[model samples]
Target: MPGPGSRPASEGPIPHLVLANVAKRFPQAASPAVDGVSLELARGEFFALLGPSGCGKTTLLRMLAGFEMPDAGSIRIDGQDMGAVPPYARPVNMMFQSYALFPHMSVADNVGFGLRQAKRPKDEIAARVAAMLDLVKLGALARRKPGQLSGGEKQRVALARALINEPKLLLLDEPLTALDRKLREETRFELVRIQRRVGITFLMVTHDQEEAMSMASRIAVMEKGRIAQIGAPAEVYERPANRFVAGFLGAINLFEARVVAATNDLLTLDSVEIGARLTVTHDRVLPLGTEVALALRPEKLSLARMPDSRWNNSLAGTVRGVAYRGEASDVEIELTCGKIVRATMANIGGARDTLDIGQPIFAGWSGEAGVVLEQ
Candidate 1:
């Protein structure tokens, strides 16, 4: 798999938003805030710019909104160059993390604020505001002020306002950060539903992996001011492009190993981490004795009291801890090789649920359960 800063070829319909060689650098910074990043979004596609704090996701979004100009490269929205376009002139609307709703204004007034600023006809503004309120399911609360609404309600009002202008691209900057856990989870689906209903291309900037994975049709994983990989959520998660992408996206166990054997569609690695030979199904053959990293998701492992013959790889260990997470349990086992490996076991009724700390156990997986990274 390709490592960080590698840009894959864009594949899809004609792009509605095209960013080419976009870069930004702040004064006296050690490195560029955003570096030579290029991406494309098809019309009506929901895309996410995902990364940790200070990885340049927000900077890229700001550049897209025309609030921050790139030091180098070009941005095109609907085939129009945005180099000279100001924030208000760009065919985009940004919903800030703070929601930015007027405290004294009613929901209807807030939703209609954009049209009013544009000096739209009174009848048109009223009709559009009513339609938007209905679309967001907040029509009944139209007379309520911002303070009178719940976090989710205020978010809907903010969304309605952002879409009121009918921008070609909608930029959401941490849209659900203010909501509580349950409300944030509920709002994710709502945002996806609303985006699909309106058929507007949504480009959301968020640090929450679950939010991006569940809502965006595709995600661009950024690291150190550049794109590490861009693909569907499943692709990015299951087949990560590098060690950074694998470990950043979710909980995974990485093991250092060297190629012991290779075939047309498989690889055998002599792993020092587990003190066992690991087998993985891969497309290409690697040279014998070549160093590589083996990555496995915690959920891919199965634990038992005894080694299973069905698994192509197995490791004996002693259970160190088990954390119950309602639907499943996260198990940490100390292998005989002195490595701690994590396995996620579902809470289905079975002997596995009766596992106790410090008990002897065997963790096993099939040959296809792991990803071999060259880096």
Candidate 2:
């Protein structure tokens, strides 16, 4: 339902891989593990399946890797149906979270194991191994065993092994979860760079929201084994389809309202709790008296003591608490309606010095910045 107004060009080429009504279920459970999910990944695209644990993201990835079969629907790669094709037979490789490196084998042997399994000539396997190591910038560590390498190094070796086969689709399962936070952040950029350079299509499964937003060109957000939303990182974050997607992506302030008036580009909603009217932009048609929800991102709302610096929608509140973040501060305000709203303010030009807890202030946002959602 997002992007109804600023529609993108329809003539742009579609993705190379497509999933048509794919569904999966496990025995002994009433619900399906993957519940009728469908999506597409273009050639040389970086795509992410993002969700929390038990959201069916892993199950869908397993199906794509041929570890599990779908109960219905079809999966196509380059316009060819993948009907029960085994993992090895398909032109795809998966990088597991465990890395699955053999402790006894050196890095070179570990990366070359796939080639050896294919019965490639010894010289050919060696040459490919060398190239893979150099691609990952790990050629110097080729002689070391997995036991001697750090978590990040082991992950790189696993990636090199997965890429050695030059699979049409590369599936990564929580590839960076094993590393520390700082290391993971650094590796995400590296992964994106490597994928861009090779021009290979990547399908990554991860529960980290920031990871998906940063590394993927497009993301499919999953919930209860179904796709909740799919779009570019900015689109998904700014124009979520529902309350769940908005809350899951980041911090948000929500208010209950009912449509009091309607127009082509705007709708006036009467907030039940605050006893105020708010105007928002939307293309969806809702009759008057229809209930709706307003979502305001924390960063979009600002606070001030004087009502003269009027925002499009302003409400009086008292500062309940303040949490000082490194570059920004979270200000919690207790509204007159007994609802709490949070605003994030950058600590610039000594702004933090003027703020104090329990001070009465005016907190609001631009009408155009907040999004309206159907109840």
Candidate 3:
């Protein structure tokens, strides 16, 4: 369990699903596929499990879907224990990365497959299928086969099929991974709209951090079969728990330092590369002469020809490389002490030959911008 200030496995407001110390391991494997993991999802909340390949996000999703059982601990859905529940009996449905639409069947038949299999009345099934198709904006194309539709259309059919079951929870496993960058970005809002419209709890598994940040109400970042952190997208990114979380989420510059002096909510650290004391805003108390790392975001730093004394932190460096990225230019600087730092400057206008290699510069940042990482 984490404190009130920290993100907990499950905090207050009624959990719709709970996993208490869940664990799983495959035979002949080096370690547990999913270690002792505990998490909770609130009713009608959209949660995302984000991590790289082989980090156990998929295995965890499988356990929730009743496709695989946990070796240890317990799983509960809406206050019911699911240890012995079969896949068909679970109130959940999955939309896979490939969409898995039936190529030969009409869109209406495909969407109604789950209802038909459940032995619902034909008239009732038809009604639900029509509504689902309309919800996904594919009502006019209901009579077409999968091959006649575009890639995004096919994905909507899969979503319609999954939603027709009226499951309490919906699982999406990289549902937009196959689409191009532009369409993937567009579909995130559509998914959010669908989830909000139906008011169903959605647990999605994805390796794309941007996708999760855009759509999920909160995110759980997993690494090596364990959760690294869980919080709102901005919280996890700006207030990272450790070095791993800070570096994994985006571009960051980590500088090793030793504490020199400390006072309430403020501390001074000494780093060889900085050639000066670094000031930081910290809520946690640390003893004198303690070692820690400062996590600095690239965009937080401002480069100038002279040191900006008002800013609390500054270092002299030479611009070593520059990369143009349309809206901003990534400038790589090699400090006097040989440490490399990266800074991103907004390109208000076309900056052709703006910063030449070997040009001397000073990088400055505010004290509150740098996060002191204990780990």
What's the lDDT for residue 146 in model 1?
96
Error of 3 at 41 (Å): 0.8
Going through the candidates in the order shown, the clash numbers are: 0, 0, 0
All models: lDDT? 0.91, 0.88, 0.89
lDDT of 2 at 97: 88
> lDDT by residue for model 1 over 1-375, one digit each (tens)?
122223333334445789999999999999999999998777778888999999999999999998899999999987789999999888899898999999989999999999998999999999999999999999899999899999889999999999999999999999999999998888888999999899998999999888899988889999989999898888899889899999889999999999999999999999876678999998889999999999999999999998888999999989999888878889999998889999998989755457899999999999999999887
Model 2: runs farther than 4 Å from truth? 1-15, 308-310, 351-354
Per-prediction TM-score to the true structure, in the order listed: 0.95, 0.94, 0.94
lDDT (10s digit) by residue, model 3, range 92-139: 999978888888899999999999889999999989998999999999
Better of 1 and 2 by lDDT: 1
| Model 2 lDDT tens row, 1-375 | 123222223224654788999999999988999999988777777888999899899999889999999999999987778867888788889999899998899999999988998999999999999988999999999999999999999999999999998888999999999999999999999999999988888999999889999998888899999999988889899998889888888899888899999898788999987889988888876899998999999999888887644567888889999998878889999988778999999888565366788889998777688899894
Q: Which stretches of candidate 1 lie over 4 Å from their true place?
A: 1-14, 350-352
Kindly give the stretch of ten consecutive residues in candidate 2 with the minimal lDDT sum: 1-10
